[model samples]
Target: MRNRHIATALLAASLLLFAAGCKKKTPVAPPPPPPPPPPTVVEKAPAAVISSFTAEPSTIVRGEASTLRWSVANATEVTIDNGIGAVSASGSRQVYPTSNTTYRMTAKGGGGDAVAAVTVAVTTPPPPPPPPPAAKASLEERMSREIQDIFFDYDKSEVREDSRATLQRNADALKTILSEFPSAVVSIEGHCDERGSAEYNLGLGDRRSASVREFLIQVGVPGDRLKPISYGKEKPVCTEESESCWQRNRRAHFVGVQ
Candidate 1:
């Protein structure tokens, strides 16, 4: 009987322990939402055409050069429409035509697109008639192209050996100036091949022209008879990168002055 009582007491104690272990609990929250989407942006160019949009010697034939000049404007970027390639960011460039073409410039900025254009008419340059059949240039006249103009290499502003030859011709002509026409004088206008900044190139033009003038004086031409001017790359006889155009750009012209 004692053993039976002890067993009943043990069973009652185990049941009470099982009831106590069956209790309840609580719940959890979710993470905060992600940040809002960022804003979008658009680019634009400035209003009105930039002054740098110009073409010099606007007429030409196939495969010849024409100088493109644009005044330095406040534009951030400048591009061309001939579909050649990326336009030089520098102010001006020389362009050659494969066919008849019109070139356009675009300035791009945060404002809008500014534009400019020039047309080149390609025509076969008229040939000069026969020399003996026609009147020939005098020693002074022959010396004009030879002496008054200093030519340069593609992309170079420095005076070259050929330029000295030009000076020599001018000096020879000047020896005859008083006998020919004492009141006449000549102007040296420097030009460049299109490949760099207009401002920088123009400055180079001045140097090149001055170089020619110095050479002429050193070789015996009267310094007082000559004037120097910088056209920079603004005037290109040819705009293409070909040998011919480059040759044309590298020259200084002697203009008649009274």
Candidate 2:
């Protein structure tokens, strides 16, 4: 009986050890898949760029104008200095600057900024030339300047001794003027004081003018170029009743006629 009991206890112990050895173990998670490989890293692009900036005519006069031109790339906004506000990426503008000037361009984008500069040279125009010289004097103006009148004594129809020297000088001047202006004619007008009647003064004035003409002809003046006329008392130089005033009215006046 004691041996059988011992055998049964040994069998139970063996069965228990076999059941424990057949059980399965749990698995690890695998390190969470290395946190998804940290994702793919990327870098962004750079700033905007300025392609070109220039002035069409760099030099100009005071009242002249010039053209400003530019080109930009990769820019979100663009602008220019000197009253030129916002502008397109590429464009041109007309400008009139009174003096020398410098223009600057700026371009901005998500990345950074870009800048460019251009200069416009200015020069003043020269003054206009002096006005043309004055023209020469005409023939009629020369005649008025060179010729003069000769005076005579009161109530005189004949050439007086005092008037002979003046008459001779006038004859010499007439010769020179007539040589240059052959077509011009001279009128010797005889005027008298207001002393006598109109018809009587007219006859006296005629005698006076004819005597002057005869004297001019004797000094070598042509008869056809000389015309003698009488004004009588109708054309007195002075109206005052005086000898000196009357003397002024008695004279032979010379005039040029074309």
Give the top-scoring candidate (TM-score): 2
Provide the RMSD of all predictions against the true structure, rounded to 1 decimal.
29.1, 16.5
Give the Å error, residue 137, model 1.
Answer: 7.6
Q: Rate the local accuracy (lDDT) of all candidates.
A: 0.72, 0.83
Off by over 4 Å in 1: 1-148
Please, what is the TM-score per model?
0.41, 0.47
Per-residue lDDT of 1-258 in model 1, one digit per residue for the tens? 999999999999989888776555356688888887565434444443475566777887766888877653555667778874446455567788766678877776546567767887778766777569366455446445445556787666567865666567667866576346567777789887787688988888888888877877887778888888898888787788777777778787877655
For candidate 1, the 10 contiguous residues with the lowest summed lDDT are 40-49
Worst 10 residues of 2 by lDDT: 37-46
Q: Model 2 clash pairs?
A: none
